[model samples]
Target: MSDICVIIAAYNAEATIAQAVTSALAEAEVAEVVVVDDASSDATAEAALAASDGSGRLIVERQAQNGGPSAARNRAVALSQAPRIAILDADDFFLPGRFARLDPDLDLAADNIVFVTPEHAARLDPTNLPAAPREVEMLDAERFALGNLAQGVHRGELGFLKPVMSRAFLTRHGLRYDERMWLGEDFDLYMRMLLLGARFGLTRAVGYAAVQRGASLSGRHRTADLAALEACCRAHLEMPASPATQEAMRRHLRQVQAKLLLRQFLDRKAEAGLGAALGFALAPPARFLPIAKGVARDKIAALRPPAPPRAERFLLPV
Candidate 1:
């Protein structure tokens, strides 16, 4: 059996920390569960510790200052001694038998995720989850980059996946989460690994439940974060890849740049005035469409009734 250490990076997650810690400890294949409280003002570290089973399998580390999720996760990885590493977000958790579904041979393995609200997650029965046929897909750098492309308001992009990775592989390649990035950090790390010849496998097994909350931290990204993501995407273009992969990188970079511009335009408008923002937005005619299109999309989306939250299990077909 492969011993896996689950790393959780938390920030003000006291209300949900215990559940995340408990669920990780429930899996027999999980040798350790490490929760790094990223300088949360709340009782997050205490809550994580209280969830320990007293078997010395849970370790809660508190950051001296808030360093974002990437830094916290990198710290957890360094502290953990397990052969395999899996990331479980403070707001998300694994279902039973999740570790058993992992492919030990692959450098990275991801499983299908079921999106649930907190209310729906609380009602889930681990032993009686909806049955889904298992399927496996091997992912290369090209496939991963292309899959991460966001199409208007789509819910499940490959970028959202959480995967288990081989610690040895990470150490051998000297790879860690880019501490500079909080947005799309997972996608950036995974793409870099794949480029380095890491074997990434995705299985259609429903063993992870990702809680979709009412107000998501992802929903509110600062302009700096978007700019960082755009820079990261640009860096990937310099790596050696097939033509298809290069094209995908170009497309993804363009998307990130567009989002960054839109964010900057909005920020300037808020800080300065509409005249200043319009001047920046329309100076380059090419920039106007992406910003205008994004604004129009959001406006239209707001007019429509919000989609009812899923009351039942809805496993994403990865």
Candidate 2:
């Protein structure tokens, strides 16, 4: 088997599963591509199966019943034999040289596995762009979570939650994506990985490109997404973290609650929602104070001026 297995959990993804599978198979480091059809009502399974080369490099199977993305991904992992795992959405495909540049065979060094970051292609959502570029970034799970506080919102899905990790790291910690969650599942899983002592090193290699479709899950389930974010924040608050990290989670909780309440107010002018949003605004959540200080400390050593602005890449499907 190759060093890595790409686990793609798909549901009713007939139009895109083929691209996802084919691109995965093109990667030399990939042992195989496992596309788990989550009981898709359409021909997603057939499309995924058709994408297979019949050379035993791709496996397309369907769940007996519809399970969410987390369950589907876990199922694929259980069936995968490679030590490292990477997730690809059915609508997305890997970029050329994704795994080769990541150098999966390198010694784990002080970390667990080599993490490759993706540069999102702007097929539909142009606002989604890469944050880090031109360098391989590294951080512990807690530090990464705290660093995210600068964004002032729960952004678990912006490539933070998706990283190529060794299967052993997850198995050792009994880690799995949240099956019960409808939103922010990525954030919850990545946060939990940090809480369980995962040290990550990241690369800015446009590893994969996921196409955004009309009325995606985030667009369809706004309310549920907010609830999941709040739930995720609450769950993280109960875990062990530094005071700064804990406070950041608390701030994120308030932001989620505020957003949830405002959305409800807009839908139906509820007094409770208005009151809750006001309550969150009045309280101090300690936003990025500690992280900012650390950043300032690091900047003091930089003698060179900031880099000049460069053109950003935005890929669209033909």
Candidate 3:
């Protein structure tokens, strides 16, 4: 019997939902594919339904209201019964024989992800995957937190890696996605599971292709959403953790806070003027440095020429 149930939370993803569904259904290890349509005004649900092979493996559910990705994912999980749960974004897909690359015994398992333009992704061949076996790295809570930190243009954030999780482990720990968070929710859930001593294994084998879009949610974040993520980090810090984990958490918190501060400054500047932004930045003594550095980076970037886009990119775990 297949052990994995692939779940997708889609919103206004009619353009790519069928591709995502077909890719998941192609994997032999996937017993079922559950897609939750978050009340999209488009034909996302219809597209997903059309991709079904009529094998009863594809389950599509329409939400009563437009909930965020977290809420939609939670709903999909409730409708799935497989031992393992794999998250497949509406704009991303799994490669053929992807589940065979990971160790199923581990509590959580992930593989390398390749980023490609939608056009390139359509022609991507599964036979191009390397035949060599890859070594698996075990991740500790501290290491996981540290790897998610943003390093400017070098965005090899571990938060982007979608891992296959043991449903039993999640149920045993009483853990679910934070419904309030539309951003950083995956990272938060994975971090909490790691803190609970969940064994997370990662392999360098390429098994997933994440479509890079200019309008992706990861690229367009609201200030309020970022602030909520920062608050979540603070709450995580309050929990009991090892010295190393605590330090890593602090660093992660600082990064989130920095981003939030920068966003707030930008919003204030846009709403009022430079003077209002400066006043807001100065009101909290800690916000000045991040905002200043952010402004400097923007100014420097504006002076440089734009670079050409790439056909394919890889974001390896740091």
Among the numbered candidates, top lDDT falls to 3
How many Å off is the CA of 283 in candidate 2? 16
lDDT string, candidate 1, 231-253, tens digits: 88888888888999999889889
Cα-based lDDT for every prediction = 0.87, 0.64, 0.90
Descending-lDDT candidate ranking: 3, 1, 2
Pairs with backbone N, CA or C atoms under 3 Å apart (clashes), candidate 3: none
lDDT agreement of model 1 with the native: 0.87
Instruction: Estimate the TM-score of every prediction.
Output: 0.96, 0.72, 0.96
lDDT of 2 by residue, 1-318 (tens): 367888999988887788789888888788878989999999999988888877687887799998788789889988888888888878767666667656453212111111222232323232334433535555554565554443523222232335677678788888888787766676677778777767565555455554544535644656666677777778888888888777767776675665565454344425456555444433454423433343354467476686532223322111
* Model 1, C-alpha of 45: deviation from truth (Å): 0.6
Off by over 4 Å in 1: 312-315
Error of 1 at 222 (Å): 1.0
Q: What TM-score would you give candidate 2 relative to the actual structure?
A: 0.72
User: 204, model 2: CA deviation in Å?
Assistant: 1.9
Give the per-residue lDDT digits (tens) of candidate 3, residues 176-235: 999989999899999989988899999888899998888888777899789889988998
TM-score of 1: 0.96
